[model samples]
Target chain A: MPVANMLIERRTFAKERGTDLIQSDEESPALTQEFMVANRMGIHARVAAQIVKVASRFNAEVCIAKSDVAANAKSILDVMSLFCPYGSKVFVSARGPDATEALSALAALFQTKFGEP
Target chain B: MINDRSSLTIRGIGAAPGIAIGKAFLLERGQIPVPRYRLFGEQSVAEECKRFEAAVKEAEADLETIKKSIRSEFSDHARLLEVQQMILRDPSIYDESLRYIREERTNAQLAVIKALRKAKELFSGLSNDEYAKSRIADVDAVGDRVVRILAGQSRSDLDHLREGAVIIAHDLSPADAIQLQAGRTLGIVTEIGGSFSHTSIVARSLGIPAVTGAEHAARLIAENDFIIVDGRTGVIIINPGETELEFYANRQDEIQTYLKQISRHSHLPAQTSDGHRVGAEANIEAIEEIVAAKDNGAEGIGLYRTEFFFMNRVELPDEESLYRDYHDLAELMAPSPVTIRTLDLGADKLTSWCPTLEEPNPALGLRSIRLCLHYKEIFKTQLRAMLRASAVAGNIRLMLPLISGMGEIFEARKIFREIQAELTKKRIPFDKNMPFGAMIELPSAVAMADLIAQEVDFFSIGTNDLIQYSIGIDRSNEHVAYLYEPLHPGVLRFIKQTVDAAHDAGIPVAVCGEMAGEPLYVPILLGLKINSFSMNPVALPRVKNLIRRSSMKECCRFVEKVLRMRTASEIEEAVSKMVMKKFPEEFHVFDPNWIGNTPLAAKKKSGS
Candidate 1:
């Protein structure tokens, strides 16, 4: 079963260069893509765990790939293994019964930057 | 055997006690390579993973014991152990170990190192805020734990530096120092640090005489040769001859005796032998220093510089918060006088509270009272706080900084009256008769002291800035720092003028500068008709000892001789020698090179 593509905000990449490691992309299919960002705070264990947990809650089968390694969207361990910093983004793809709902949720999460205020 | 000939003897500030002579062990970051994991076989890997997990648990237990041992010494630092615990329990490290053993067939140590390195990289990339920065230490702890787990050693056996051994490191993590047995450790010699570095502060707190900033300190000292470290003077002596060792032994005894003497007289007054009473006060920024001040026998807090609270945080503290801080401090120093100086900010003392201005020379630019006056709301809030605080336990005196003329004094007094009127209208329970004074730190202030004295209750000469302002030299500028002469004829003249002016108006004058508290300048300050001295708490005993040993008449004579000197160098050389000759032990130069950084300047450096 393939999920419908969800419209997402235009994502701007950070100027700083780093690795692209995806932790989650189940919510927003259009926005669930990896990026090379040099964000001040790298993708950390807590951030990775949060993204994985959020993605796991959705019905869409979210798949995140970083570098050459792709892992299930639910594994915190797999997400942290990517070693992405501020400007790195990972490739995200989700296809399932609730793909549109998953994509929309995921896009909102990326836009808000993993809930960091 | 533990006292291997290859062990090094290094000179450092001896903070703690006992002897540790051990083999040379260098804790260098370069030795540890970045670790990587690989896959080998699955069936055998499952068995190895179990062994690795068991080893990690043993190591974790050992770390807990070490944490408990230091729990008392570093009560506030127990949080460090919690971070270490999290690192040890990190799933990334455990999972990586399993993966490596199954796939790469690497040893447990290699796997652990690889896992920890990955974690370190993750934390290192985080933001600079405390939440992220704290995890960096966790990474280092993880590395330490991995080594311990692989070695199959308990934490007790980990700190196995030999007796009287000097451990050299590129830079020691605070955690490493904590794990070392305090009583057995000789000294820490690091290649990194300035005077106030974290390592230095920790060394001071631990009392583990240490000497840092030595270029290749580890490489320079070899196997067990005798060493001498003068932490007070920053002098290091290596492999001293018999006579040199004897000299140092005797010097150490003298220092011990001196410390004992100070401890005995800690509670006594700072009155000179000739019956002239000199009020010795402490300069404090944080309220925590108030405890130290009391312990060190301070009669009062002379300079409660409040700028530290406003620096780098908020634009301005609301009046309620200001009132609470001021009043709380006043209560703490109840019955004892606590002189609260208003928010003294300059371009150099830039804070988020004030907008940064373009001042070619911040030292001479709009600063101190000038900056406050320009910002009426800021100045009034502070003034109101002081007035509110005056009603509390202590006798509160308002001190204005950088007053250049009678007009400035008048303006300051006018503002004070306005605040008092507001408090009166509000019917706030505040003291109406709080004494107000001005700091005579500028040349113009000294020039118009007589006129300004009539409007103020007293005058406190801030000698550090007076020297800089009078000579038009920046004391902080290292190239021109040598020009920061406190005894310059012009500086002395200004100090004398201000002191005399206050005396003429029947008001007392006290030196609240580093000069007033120096052992060498104690006599001169007393002789110049200065009635009181205020300095950092650590300096109280030395200043008090000097005051107790000297006569005001002799001090005046010394001041007379010094005032007659033509040049700044001549005044400095003559005063230092005269005092050393008269009271060699008590009056030696506190810090020969640090002559320019006086008590007030020290506080200024911290706040500004």
Candidate 2:
């Protein structure tokens, strides 16, 4: 798939999942997605804070994992500890009601290179 | 380490020239202790997490305050603080510590340490790469701040340092070095750093005695220990004996008297004894330096470097901003011509928006006028701004830097005309005959000065680059730096040729380089009929004193004799002898050996 089309499909899927989350009251479903670190600086402290800020906006437990070490996405130290260099892929997952919304926001942030040139 | 109880002396590189004696104030980087403990209950874990969050909040607030205070003086350091604040609020750190407290039942302090250690390890793994490794220091700084806040320890504040105190540090970052108050801090001795480090530069500009690369400076010098820092000799004497103290006290008195004598001529005009008037101007980079230049009795602003406006900025400054800056400068130095040099960025100084291409020899690559020509819009905006500024305030001249040939001059003039025509159509009031000048920096420019002078209204010989290019020695390179001689016979010939060409073309020439500031070269430059001198503000009074005391006839005679010398050493010897004979007091303060060559010694030899 073209990268732009894949991004559009991902957004639509996230919106549908968010609607489903509103419909259900208890036992929120977990959502997971993998993304490549696109920024050349590779998610240093500043970029990590940016990701955490986006994740904190949603009422969900966002966690980022590289191999076996899973770090809370809402924590900058944890995201930075992931040591995700450029071209490296990490799995981003969220639990609770706003899981889909949180995952979608994070994926968009990564794709945009965190607004850096 | 040297014993603190006994007298000891250490040697380092003398970065600045002065002598200072004061009590040592040890400035050690604060370290935080992290102790491990277990949380027995849910309430304890929650309480520990709350404490950790509060500390992080305090650290973030502290960094914000620092950023605000430093923004005006040190913009680059303020940017670094922004990164630090982000690190402080990183969720990865907060969440990992929270998890450790909740899952492993550990205390908040221990959990925070573990999380920070993980990040540190990741950063250290990229130790071989300088960029990646530098990021580790930022991480550590943020981490250390949080830990210190938790421990209730205060940050190291160099801004409010006590007067007459000697600062002894392991190493000083540029931000910390800039924070050292000028009058309060007497001297600086660091354990690590070369003579050309940022800290040394700041110390020199502040006129403070500084010694760097002193082994164990922070460890050996205890707090409140009496220390003497001799910046000229790069010596640090601790717990000095009475005799040593007396000797340095006399030397300090001599330096003060010498400085006072030179400062007496600050308000005097630079004129030869034969009544030949010369202009002594200043080369300034920032707007704040204009007041200093005026205070130092500058006849006018000779070289206003425009690169400072482009540096440490995200985008290029627009026409209005550039115009306002130039207009303000011209108004401040009213009635005196302010020669503003267009953007001389690239070589050693690079901008983010317009990055120079990567090359092995950046010094000789596309830079200055070459780079400006490549980016026409950038060049046009600047010319338009300068013209607009000239409309608001008269006495503004445009100078082109690093022009190698007439081709660059013709191209620049074409753009200037276009801008002038557009501004003219708009009915803006500007000096239609605003003078344009070129800097003769390259050997090619010197060789073709006569041809280039015909096109420009004036010429300024930038000896710093001219000597480097002529000698094929980069002055910054330590191995070949010794070969960078300004008094070489070839360099003199170039200056003589360029000055003659500028005069022949009915235009004046000015030396706005390091050579103009040196007292030893004053007579030689005057002999070449180069009257105008532009240099650092601090050197104005002394150079003016030298020019004011000598006659043009005698200077010309001395230059004629020295030009006949074959080697730099021979020329230097003759100049030194002449200077010692004429200005014995000034020469004696700078060089003790000149004392033996005084007229007294000559009279004694005649009697013998």
Candidate 3:
């Protein structure tokens, strides 16, 4: 039931971010998954640093995309530029041997809201 | 120099009322100038980048040192400092500075400024939200640190403050405010903030004289300059002559002596002449206050404001922390009933979690029980903890604040039942028969009092918010503060109605606001038949003394007459005349001046 509601919310919000997406020019696309920013403060600087910290742990080259802006998940500044406000959605894509692990780790961060209220 | 210097007074809002004559410790944070100088050569440009990098690292180390040294109670401040450190290292500012240095050929200081400006552009581009603006401010704060470091300056540490230092600062964050040592920080004067700000709350809690909103305090008051802070009236007299010092010193002595004299008899039971009695309890947040409360003859904790456990942090306190706090408080109070009010954080206190709920008018916004119900998970976690803690001390009683109507009471009762069932199934022992109550601080609650009284175990009146909301004026507003009269006709009528409703339903009522404490208002409350008085510990003795001296017959007569009166001034005049006429010696000794709020105003902000 919760998932169904989230699905509708995702669609309603994506209608806005959909206008900003640009297709990647790579020959084959990286594995991608979408996550919602749940914390009240959204993907702020400190949360961005947590993503960079997690992303840098693996060999995967990860990027977080929101509103037409794709940021290198290893760069705090780059991740902060994406600016995922609370309740917004972001797509995480990665390419490497540990791409699956990288996506899951970022997923967990978003799930816990980087351990914030 | 002392002889030549004339006394100059700087006026600001009095956050805490007291008198402090001490030397100044100017905590001029983030006030350094950014010096712009051109790099002479490639060698100098490279050196400037290294300089900026080293300063950034040093600032990081400095913040880490402070964070490590910070006690666990200030975990919120530590988290905030950690974010600042991350901002210091972010490529948006760090790498951007290096990029600007190499590309724009600007000096490192100028490069740092440009980098920060670039970061600001990126943040503002995301959205013109308050969150983005705060992020920009964080960047600016980090930029200031690097600039100050580059210019060969050091950060002022509040932890190492000298004794008798009255801290004069731009402002202290809530965490910094909590870090102030009572003996070390004789007083606090900030350039910004009102009585409700964290600095004021902490200053009042620590019993330090504090004055905020002094615009020229930092610029005018020099380090080690002798200053007298009259926290009662928000006056700071700098370079005072002998006569001025003598007068302030005498006033200080008189206040101390009067308080000491009254507190000597504070432990006496609050039983009126005609054998009428009411519980004299104390309102407190920290567990450290159990001793003070006990010393002042507080029968039990009247209002254990649980918001302190949740405030000043990026994360909500887990069930474990909340449980431990409630359990410890329950154990300390033992057989005495401790009423724990659920989260009553208005927008101002819930800053960390309610970034999105920044209502234009927060007082009328979703708060207290409303905020709890909206954040169900948060509320549930607290309820679970409170129930678990109740298992340990059986004396814990649950109370809801700002309960506007019957719907909220029913809603909270439902939550309580769910938690109880969960506890029962889990075999977690708790006080199943624990008393539940509602705080009667709103007119709607008063109107629905008889219904609410039947539903709850008791009623506690928060007269601070009751007066504010009842009068349709913010007491914090200087223009309307005078109208914050507990004796106001409508407020008095509301109190009378609530007490009547509770008695009709065979339940007790406690008044736990400023009105519950003041001697001037004791007769009025006792006359209204309030079952208990819970207020600041210092106010307990005098309030109890007045209650002990007066009879229910006289009080009832006064109330009957005051009820017929039309204006607050008339009611106030009659009460003052009767109380003063009866207890002239006690009145003369304490001199509470009977009019202004005095030191009693320094208690923590209203929990509405």
Isolated chain B TM-score per model: 0.74, 0.74, 0.73
> What local distance difference test score does each model get?
0.66, 0.76, 0.79
What tens digits encode model 3's per-residue C-alpha lDDT throughout B31-146? 67776777788898889878878988987887787688665655555776777787787767887789888877788888888878877766666543655666666676678777
Worst 10 residues of 2 chain B by lDDT: B595-604
| TM-score of model 3 (CA atoms) | 0.66
lDDT tens per residue, model 1, B1-608: 11233322333332222122223345554344434444356755676677788877776776677677773646434545544555565556676666667667876668877676665555454333333454555565666656655665422233545454455666777677666554655556677765445565555544455667766776776545455555543444555545445645665666557756775786799888988898999887766567668877889988988876666442355676677778778888888999888878785556444667878877778888988888888889888878887888648988998889987787877888888888889898788788888898988888888998898998888888888888988865879987887778888888888888898999988888878756677777888988789886666777888888888888888888888889877877777677767787654323323333332213322443
Docking class of 2: incorrect
* Tens-digit lDDT string for candidate 2 (B1-608): 22234777787777766788888887766455667888888788789889988988887887676566552545545666776676666544666677788999887777877777766655554323433445666676667677766777653446435466989999886546755666778899998887656687667666788999999988889988999897766788889767567767777778778878788778888999899888899888766667668767889988998987776544566776677788889888888989999888774455455655677898898789998898888889999888888875578989999989999999999999988999899987778888999999999999899999999999998999999999999977979886788888889989999998999999999999888977778899999889599987767887898899989999889888878889887887887888888988777765554322222212322343
Q: Which stretches in model 3 have alpha-carbon errors above 4 Å? A: A1-31, A36-49, A58-60, A77-88, A95-117, B1-5, B8-11, B25-31, B155-164, B169-184, B202-208, B214-225, B243-457, B465-501, B517-529, B534-608
Clashing pairs in 3: none
DockQ of 3: 0.21
Candidate 2 runs further than 4 Å off: A1-117, B1-17, B21-30, B36-156, B168-178, B189-205, B210-251, B312-314, B347-358, B593-608
lDDT of 2 at B501: 94
Which candidate leads the pack in DockQ? 3
Interface RMSD of each: 9.0, 8.1, 5.6
